[model samples]
Target: MMFRQLFDHASCTYTYLIADPVINAAILVDPVLEQVDRDLKLLDELGLTLQFCLETHIHADHVTGTGKLRDIAGCLGIVPQGAQASCADRYIQDLELLELGKVIIQALATPGHTDNHMAYMVNGNLILTGDALLIRGCGRTDFQGGDAGTLYDTITQRLFTLPDTTLVYPGHDYRGFTASTIGEEKQWNLRIVGRDRDSFVQFMSHLDLPDPKKMMEAIPANEECGRVSVVV
Candidate 1:
């Protein structure tokens, strides 16, 4: 298995490339629209055929590259089962496994940041927590059907139950930190460490974060699987 983490500075998004070198097949997770060329080049240089472009959820920050990548590479577009992506070629359900050679990706429904968000666990040891859990902080539960209590339950009940050593690679990272382990976060993540459900919900309600800068344009485009014409 081959894995690479790519970053988009503009939106602070993290796009992951996971592949099975034996079969030369790759899947891009939470890709950014502006980084399509870069991702394509990387895939080409790696001698891999892109078999899937997967989204964790319908994003409200950056438009996805799935649609364009699908058009260019003829790969299927996959999204979480309840994501409002009409153009997705497939909707992956909870605990469903997507395999390429020996690599297996399992979809875990961790809906709180968004009503239909998902986190992908790869090979049982690594997790791609798409906005569900961050390094120290978690995603804001203020919009897109977000609920603070639900997010708390997801972190404590679902994700925290994983092996303490499981690697956590988040969808976006504003801080310079790259990755963290489930044990580290479980012990140090201030957002969920000692807070109960009600307290966590109350705390999240007071964050008062502003919407993402691209929210106005990103949501609708993401719903269409990143198909939109820019007026440039």
Candidate 2:
């Protein structure tokens, strides 16, 4: 197993590459549009073939590189089954496993940040948590189709139930923190620390975060898999 973490400084997003070196099969999770070239270069240099592109959710801060990477690698673009991303080649449902060489990627429904949000588990050892659970905080439930109550359940019932040592790789991290264990998040994440659904909702509603600067542009582009105004 081989893993690489790529960070996008502008949006504080993280993209991950998990590969099975023995079979030369690989998958990219939550790849950033602006960083596709860098990612491709690295993949080329490593002599690995991209088998799939996995999206944790549709992002509002930055467009995803699913479509671009698909073109580059002729790989499948995987997104949540019910998600509305236009470029998704494969619609993933709960517990759906994608077999790639020696690695198995399983999708876990974890809606909170969005109704169709999902988390991917790799070989039951690592979880790629989209916006559902961050390092010290959880995703804000103030956006479209976002519900605090749902987020609460998703975290406690679904994610927290995983093993204590399960590695957690989140989609975005404004702070320098890169990764953490499920146990650490369960113990320290402020959003879910001893707070009930109503209280959590109330707290999140008042956070007063500035609207994502690229929301207007990024959402549309992401829906189409990072294509600009013109069709490729």
Candidate 3:
């Protein structure tokens, strides 16, 4: 298995490239549209054929490259089940496996930041923790269909149970904290560690985060696979 983590400075988002050398097949996750040219160039240089373009959730921060990549690479677009993204070829469910060459991508439903959010585990070692978990914190639960209690349960019961050595690659980070282990987050994450459900909810409710600057534009564009047909 081969993987590369790409970062978009503007939105502090991380995009991923996972590939299998044997069959030369690859999949891209959470690609940013602005950086699609560079990503596509890299894929071309690597002699890999893109098999799938996967989205973890409908983003509220930046436009996605799923549609562009699908069109360019002629690959299938995969998204979380119930997320209404235009042109998505597959709607993944919890425990669904996507096989591309030697790489096996397993989908895990992790609804906290958003009701349709998902985390992808690659080869059982690397976990792509979309907006569900981050290095020192977790995603905000103040968005549409977001609930703090549900986030706590998802992290403690579902994600924290993974092996300590499992590498975590989050969807976004602004403080230069690129990645962390599941064990590290389970033990040290300020939001979800060592707190009861009620305390967690209270803490989350008190956090006065400003609404995302791109929310009014990004959400609707993201839902339409990066097109601006309707306003968010």
Q: Pick the candidate with the highest lDDT.
A: 1
lDDT of 3 by residue, 1-232 (tens): 8899999988999999999988988899999988889899999999989988899999998888887888888988888998978657889999999998778899999998999999999999989999999888989999868899999999999999999999999999989988899999988998887799999999999999998888998888888888664332
Backbone clashes under 3 angstroms, per model: 0, 0, 0
Residue pairs in steric clash, candidate 1?
none
Q: Give the lDDT of residue 113 in candidate 2.
A: 90
TM-score of each: 0.98, 0.96, 0.96
The lDDT of model 3 is 0.90
Question: Which candidate would rank higher by lDDT, 2 or 3?
Answer: 3
Better of 1 and 3 by lDDT: 1
Note the residue pairs that clash in candidate 3.
none
Give the Å shift of residue 47 in candidate 2.
0.9
Q: State the displacement of the C-alpha of residue 1, model 2, in Å, after optimal TM-score superposition.
A: 1.0
Instruction: Report the poorest 10 consecutive residues by lDDT, candidate 1.
Output: 223-232
Q: Please give the lDDT score for candidate 1.
A: 0.94
- TM-score for candidate 1, please give it: 0.98
* Candidates 1 and 2, the one with greater lDDT: 1
Flag regions of model 2 displaced more than 4 Å: 230-232
